[model samples]
Target: MVWDDFAINNLAIYLLDKPNKDRKVALFVKGCDSRGVVRMLQDNQIKRENIYLIGIPCPGLKDPKTAARGYYKDAGSVPEAKKCEECRHPNPVLYDEILGTPVEEPQEKDRFAEVNELEKKSVDERYAYWTAQADKCLRCFACRNVCPACSCPDCMFDCTKPRWLDKEVSTEQNQFFHMIRVWHVADRCIECGECERVCPAGLPLMQLNRKLIKDINELFGPFEAGLDLEQRPPLTHYETGDPEELM
Candidate 1:
């Protein structure tokens, strides 16, 4: 019942230290969280035998900040999280035990609708739009911290040997940080939108992530990361027949 009250996708599983190999664990998962677990298993970060997944069909989650502000007259009137509104997968793809009857997944609509609109703008317009968004960045790293895909033992942001990012926060530095961060996770992003929700400045981080997803789909032919545990990420595999756009 606790899991039913909140969208567990907002919780960052990687932040928890690795569990003992002999210890078994059980947790509730929504569709996206299930994908995160699959990704961890695929990366050899966790063993499938060490965990039990209890799946729940997520209707959506209320925006906690909005609810705190008294934006809704009652609990029933609370708005769904933006990511949930656009979510294509509401039922867990993989689960050891399902807790409810499977809800019908949303119809296949243009998930990249916002990204497509951004693409229609002139190059300069797009640049200006992103620059303004980047200007508000605090370099807080909340986005990176909340991401399940960012499981590096030592993150590049914290590296000092080559100093990937400068200590000062500026528009240029923020832009570079976001650009590189998105690229690093581009092939693995599950589109849970936790990064945007956790952001203090309210940057539309999903738009940047989805843009990369759109490009990857077009160039590599409709690849969705974290959907199938057996599938290799498009960027991780090389094919001779791959498009020459980057070449």
Candidate 2:
């Protein structure tokens, strides 16, 4: 099936549960989804020989909420999703077969532009800004559920034994929840932006992810997770020349 704006679900996450490991399967993938597949392959979560990948270049999906607001004259004129606008990879990075002619990758934009602006503010200002955003969170976990990078068998939030977080939805608790989740996925997040899209609270979750990505890039010398199957994540590997700021 051809993926369009309506097909926003990340198929890579579903394919992780291979009922019959020996049975081969094939699925269509967009630029971001293909990266997630490669990531699973790198982690040995899925076998490359067990599946066929059909890659397709993405022109970008439109925001359904924006479309519902009568923002476009026609469906074809709908504005591109904010995440797609900042996407550096519109063409699939890995595939067994390509569905159509590859499109040229868009020029790299300031992906961390918003993050940089927030950093210019005072510590208290930044804290207040994030606190306000966190207060609106419903704790629905839709963001966590939709993220392809969050493949943890037992997410901390759902663990009742240790009860990492109390059931109360206070501002402090909310912020703590979000911060911990972001840090956990900092090294592996592919920036698919699915978390933000699925958030019922309309929180700008991508801003937080982009902030971590920007910091990691600056400190670790420009690493992009899931791009190379052989490459180790910055957090998982160490180098003698690595920055000592964290120390």
Give Cα-based local distance difference scores for all models.
0.81, 0.83
Model 1 lDDT, full chain set: 0.81
Over 1-247, each residue of candidate 2 has an lDDT whose tens digit, in order, gives 5457756566788766657345788878888888888777766778899889889888777777768877577878877887788788878888999988988898878888899999999999999999999999999999988777887767889999989898999899999999998998898899888899878889999899988888889888788877888888888678888787643
Q: Write the per-residue lDDT of candidate 1 for residues 1-247, one digit (tens) a residue.
A: 3544444454436424555444787767788888777776766767888788888878777677667777667877877777788888878877889997888889897989899999999999999999999999999999888887776768889999999899999999999999889998888898888888888899999999999889888888887777899999888779998887732
Number of the top-ranking candidate, with lDDT as the measure:
2
Query: Which pairs of residues collide in candidate 1?
Result: none
After superposing candidate 2 on the true structure, give the runs of residues whose Cα lies further than 4 Å from its correct spot.
18-23, 69-73
Best by TM-score: 1
lDDT score, candidate 2, position 6 = 53
RMSDs, each prediction? 1.9, 2.0
Q: Superposing every Cα of model 1 onto the true structure, what RMSD results? A: 1.9
Over 4 Å off in model 1, which ranges?
12-16, 19-22
lDDT score at residue 51, model 1, on the 0-100 scale: 81
- Give all TM-scores, in the order shown: 0.93, 0.92
